[model samples]
Target: MMLSLFDQFMSPTFLGVPLIVLALTLPWLLFPIPSNRWLNNRFLTLQTWFIYRFVRQLFLPMHRSGHKWAVLLTSLMLFLITLNMLGLLPYSFTPTTQLSLNLGLAAPLWLATVLIGVRGQLVYSLAHLVPEGTPTLLIPVLVIIETISLLIRPLALGVRLTANLTAGHLLIQLISTATFVLVTTMPLVSFFTATLLVLLTILEIAVAMIQAYVFVLLLSLYLQENV
Candidate 1:
């Protein structure tokens, strides 16, 4: 039987058990644990360097209060990038493509930032609902607009990730399918299509990494507003 294009986004199952848990946990296994010795392999050294640079750059603009989030944000960035890159492999499932999983990740973190803002500076947080030097007539309208925008942050985060990944995957599948069909009917055209497919694959790889970074970077910005 022919499969639907969206079938790739569905969670795989075996023996009546869903494999999403395995997919989510698999990326961590690929990472090497820190060694006790001062010296380490090239791979470990590179990984450490990448993480150090990412954390330093990410937190450079934030206040000291936001420094505590370095570990959480760094881990999140690694987790997301791993899942995204791994999904590019043949026969692999991408959990982030699922809206539920993406929302699950976005909601709590976004809520935490809002809560932190309220707890630390309720007046400042509430002040965000109303901009400075606003006209009396527009005050209520602006407040409503700002509140809606504030509430939409998590939804935007989840949808942005899901839509981007889903679109890229669908495009790749469509092009590959077209290339396969053309291979037998039109060898010359198929060769060119296959070349296009390779370029698209490289673009998708960049998209995967970027989307992961953008996801976490937005979270940090939200935290910056609060902390």
Candidate 2:
């Protein structure tokens, strides 16, 4: 019968297995592995160039020590963007839309950066909890506030990704349902709604890529501070 809009966000299952397992693994297979040949196919060439540019831009603001995270961050970006774009297609699930998945990805990486900061520069990391010119009475309060903010970064990262994707998907589903309902009784209105859907779809595609970039970019910024 009828499906709720939120139903689309549920992780699908086949037999006893979750399809999310496949969704998460599928993106990596879509990429072509680099061959030993001196020349590569156009797709591989373009892929390599795009990744090179992205890594260069992402790491430009960080110290040399932060460069070690290049591979992890780049892979994460591609993984996220692919998961997001794939979900836009018919009959596919987006793992990134799940809060648990997003937090699973965010928490450890964010923790790693914090740990690195603690390990490398403990005093500096502690200093971040308080500003230099804090009034005598406010130092403890500022430290507590800053501590809470620091702890919330990973939660914020996960929620930001989840909220953005969920909102876009819901909007798309709602508009498509309206367009479908209007097609019989109000063809002209349906046409305009359909056009709007097309434009939103395009915007969603850009949002998919941008959200992925923002996720990794913020992580890199955190790393830069630590390094």
Candidate 3:
């Protein structure tokens, strides 16, 4: 039986239980746990260096208070990158492609940052909705627009991640199918398409890592404003 292109996006089940749970949890186990030893192995050393640089750069713009989110945000970055990269493998599910999952991750964190802003600096938070020296006639309209923009942040985050991953996966699948079909009838053309597929796969790998970074980076920026 032939399957649809999007069938790959559907959640798989075993014994009537969703495998999405395993997809989400398994990536955590893939990461190497830090040990108590003073000296680290090469892989662990590289991992530590990369994470240190990432966190240092990520929180560079924020206040000291925002640094509190380092562990949460860094862990989230790793989780996302792992899921995205793993999803690119054969016969694997990409949970982040689901808007619901993405929104579930985005909304609470976005709201928490907003709440922190409101709690710590209520006047400043409200002031963000209306910039200084606004015309009296435009104040109400500007406030409304800003309010809508503020509320749309989480939705935007979710949609951006879903759209990017979905598009990349679809494009890769379409090209791969084309290459397979052409290989028998048009060897030369299929060769070129196969080469293109390889390049696209490489590009998709980069996209997976980058989209994960951009996701956490935006969250940090939002937190920066509030903190």
- State each model's C-alpha RMSD to the native: 0.8, 0.8, 0.9
lDDT score for candidate 3 against the true structure = 0.95
Flag regions of model 1 displaced more than 4 Å.
Answer: none
lDDT of 1 by residue, 145-187 (tens): 9999999999999999999999999999999999999999999
Q: Residue 143 deviation, candidate 1, in Å?
A: 0.6
TM-score of each: 0.98, 0.98, 0.98
Ten contiguous residues with the weakest lDDT in model 2: 1-10
lDDT of 1: 0.95
Q: Where is model 2 more than 4 Å wrong at Cα?
A: none
Question: Could you tell me which residue pairs clash in candidate 1?
Answer: none
- Candidate 2, residues 1-227, lDDT tens digits: the string is 44788989999999989999999999999999999999999999999999999999999888999899999999999999999999999989989999999999999999999999999999999999989999999999999999999999999999999999999999999999999999999999999999999999999999999999999998998998899
How far is 218's C-alpha from truth in model 3 (Å)?
Answer: 0.5
lDDT of each: 0.95, 0.95, 0.95
Residue pairs clashing, model 3: none
| Clash tally, candidates in order | 0, 0, 0
